[model samples]
Target: MARVLHNCPAPAKLNLFLHVTGRRADGYHLLQTAFQLIDRSDSLDFDTRDDGVILRTTAVAGVEHDSDLIVRAARLLQQATGSNNGANIAVRKNLPMGGGLGGGSSDAATTLLALNYLWQTGLSRSQLMALGLQLGADVPFFLFGHNAFAEGVGEQLMRIDTPDHWFVVIEPGVSIPTAAIFASSELTRNSKPVKMLDFSGAYIRNGRNDLQAVATKLFPAVAEAIDWLGQHGTARMTGSGACVFCAFETRDEAEAVLASVPKKWRAWIARALDEHPLSHLQ
Candidate 1:
């Protein structure tokens, strides 16, 4: 029988608040943020092959199959485990690219996790997470599988419980390149380092995104989205964002606001998730 895992989900994330706290000599900015999984996701399906040939069976516009993170992830896992097996991976991409929602990173994490199980490679979760980091900083957090307080280039993580809040997310109709934002001289890389307790306390729902200022300034559509959404609640840009979101206490509260958002921008509502959907994969 051909082994197959179908409809596996790769969920999106929201950075409740992101702070650039420092810089490394290597040009990576140190960070502090909360990672919240949401119901929104990109889905993947895998079918094993005997020929040891890995391939993506679907097309993602503007992304070459060989260069896609999904393909890179599968090949990386095969190398690490010395597994003489490969699979045809298909991705149903729902999340927007470069939206600061961790779409690509989450997709890569799912690939590592699903292939690990399908290939019967018994790697511990921590080992998988370490491997995930080589792909991207945010990749490990998806594999961490919990709402987390993240620091140090967004890789260091510790689980934290988050309230089940409803969120209204708006797409600002522009794809903001992450590298351009970080390279801006206007970006402040000196936010004071904060402890987990600080995130737990006064800023639990009140924290700010240090990158928001630079992002908004660079992308007016983002600023317009944030300004309009702010009327509903504590609206903020999630990452180095082109999407802005605000949290509400109830789904109704979120929906009501969603209804009133200008039709020009695509918007939707999602509930907060404390754990990744694929967390249980060994």
Candidate 2:
């Protein structure tokens, strides 16, 4: 009999703040950032198939069938567990790609966790997270199952408590490639590192993203969005992004700001989530 899990939510993450401390010799940038889980999500449905053929049955525009993270994650787990089991995967994409919301990584993490259960693979959470790392740097953080402070190319995670808040996310209508942002000579890579003990909820608004300068220069819409949102609160870029966000004390406050956004842009009012929606599932 086939097993099914329906309406699983792969929640997006906001980089409350991102700092580049240095670049490794291998060209990977070392980062320090806090990942905030949000209610906004990409919903997924998975059905196990006894035929042992992993496939993404739904269409995601601009994404190739084999190139989809959901497909890649399923295949990786299939190989890891030596399971012939397969799945019919459906991704209902709500989050924008390259918006720095970690949509794809969250989807990939959900795939591994869901497939492990459906396939009856006895891999531990740690094991699943390790496999997720091979897929993307941000994947393991989702598997970590909580708001986290991340470092070491975004894989090293320490779960943290964040005050519940609402966010006004302004999508700049441009896709800023992370590779180009990181490769930019103008990007700062010498931010002094700070420890978790140094983090405080009171200072949330004081945090900054070091990549913002370069990103703004490359994608002017991002800069414009940031400037507009700043009128409501402290606006900053999330990850290497075209989407800029500002935190608000309440949902209504966030929504009010969202309402004032220019008609040309897209915006959302999302509440911060303390834990991943799938935390209990795993």
Candidate 3:
């Protein structure tokens, strides 16, 4: 019997707080953020084929196969592993692209992990993370498979257990260009680095995103989203985003806020996951 293909989830991420502490000589910004996983996720199914590596994408809206990160990830894995057998990859994309949710990175990480298992490559998690770093900085965190504090262009990660909460994420009908935000001179390039312990109580009281002000200026929708969500509770933008999210004490509270969100904007309520969905693979 043909090996039954396995299906896996690629969860979204929220940057609870992001601070651009400095810039590297090479122009990469040094950042500090707490990455929290969310329940909302995209799905990927993998099956081995007899022919040369063929990547077939399903009906994913707003993404072309050639430009899709999943395809790029699969190709990267193929090249890195030097595998003779090609696999068919089907992605069911639910996460919005360029929303600063780390959807693409999660998908890439899933592809790397799934393929490694299916191919019997026996590559260790560290090995997979090394390969994932080539795809994207967030990719490594997903390979590590847990909530983490990230720094250094978001590649360096230290795992930590974060509080469990429900988040109401609101995405205004606008796409924030990450490159545009990063290139802006107005973006914050210096913030005092704080220790993890310093953040425990400080986060709830004074958590902040250095990019929020600049991003809001560039995209009014982000500002609007933040303003809208703040009506319910403390709200903040995650990463370089057009999406703003607010945490609630319970799922019902989050859902209650979701009901009142403007019809023009898209929104969802997701439980904050302490462990990444891919943790079992680790």
Candidate 4:
């Protein structure tokens, strides 16, 4: 029988705040943000196979199998270890794509972590993280295992304690491409950077997403969602987003607001998580 790792979770993350501090010469914008884990997630099941063939048994709409991050991460791990083993990865996706929830990156990180253990490749957490970075910037954070303050195109992570507040998230029913927002001429790229000490408090409204303006301007639905949610609290966009969220002090407060959210949009409430669900894997 093949060895299997089932129900491996890849939780969604909310960027408590995202600021474009500057632009690197390579065109990757410098960012400072706090990543907060939430209950919303994508889960995976890995079935080990003897042949050296990495495959995604589940298909995501509009995403090619060869282009899926899950497959790429698995293949990368194989190449790095020079291992002949392979696996069939089945994803149970619950998070929205292009909502800035880090779904794909999280899935990729989970693949790297899970396969390393299942295949008995014996890679360290730091080694896995280094390989994850080649997949995407947010991949390393998911592997980092805690809420963090990130910098340098979002690869620099310092564990930060986040408030246990509940968040109400609204998906505006549109896909906002991350590249479009970053490449926009109107996007702000020069917000003055702040020290980590300034954000150690992990308050709900510590800062703002510089990408929000460009995203909202390009997509009116996002602006409408933010405007509606802002009526309840300090509503803001997470990462380069199509989803907007507001943090509340308690579950009751978050649920109450969630009740009043317009029916035209998809919305839900999730409590903040201090660490990743897969933290124990390492």
Among residues 3 or more apart in sequence or in different chains, the pairs in candidate 4 whose N, CA or C atoms overlap within 3 Å are none
Better of 2 and 3 by lDDT: 2
Pairs with steric clashes in candidate 3: none
RMSD of each: 1.0, 1.0, 1.7, 1.1
Candidate 3 yields a Cα-based lDDT of 0.83
Give the per-residue lDDT of model 2 (tens digit) for 145-213. Answer: 999889999999998899889998988999888999999999889998887788776435677999999
Pairs clashing within candidate 1: none
What's the true lDDT of residue 222 in model 2? 93
Give candidate 4 misplaced runs (Cα > 4 Å): 202-204
For candidate 1, lDDT tens digit of each residue in 164-208? 899999999999889989999999988888877656835647678
Query: What lDDT does model 4 reach?
Result: 0.90
Q: Could you tell me every candidate's TM-score relative to the true structure?
A: 0.98, 0.98, 0.94, 0.97
Q: Is candidate 1 or candidate 3 better by lDDT?
A: 1
Model 2 lDDT, full chain set: 0.90
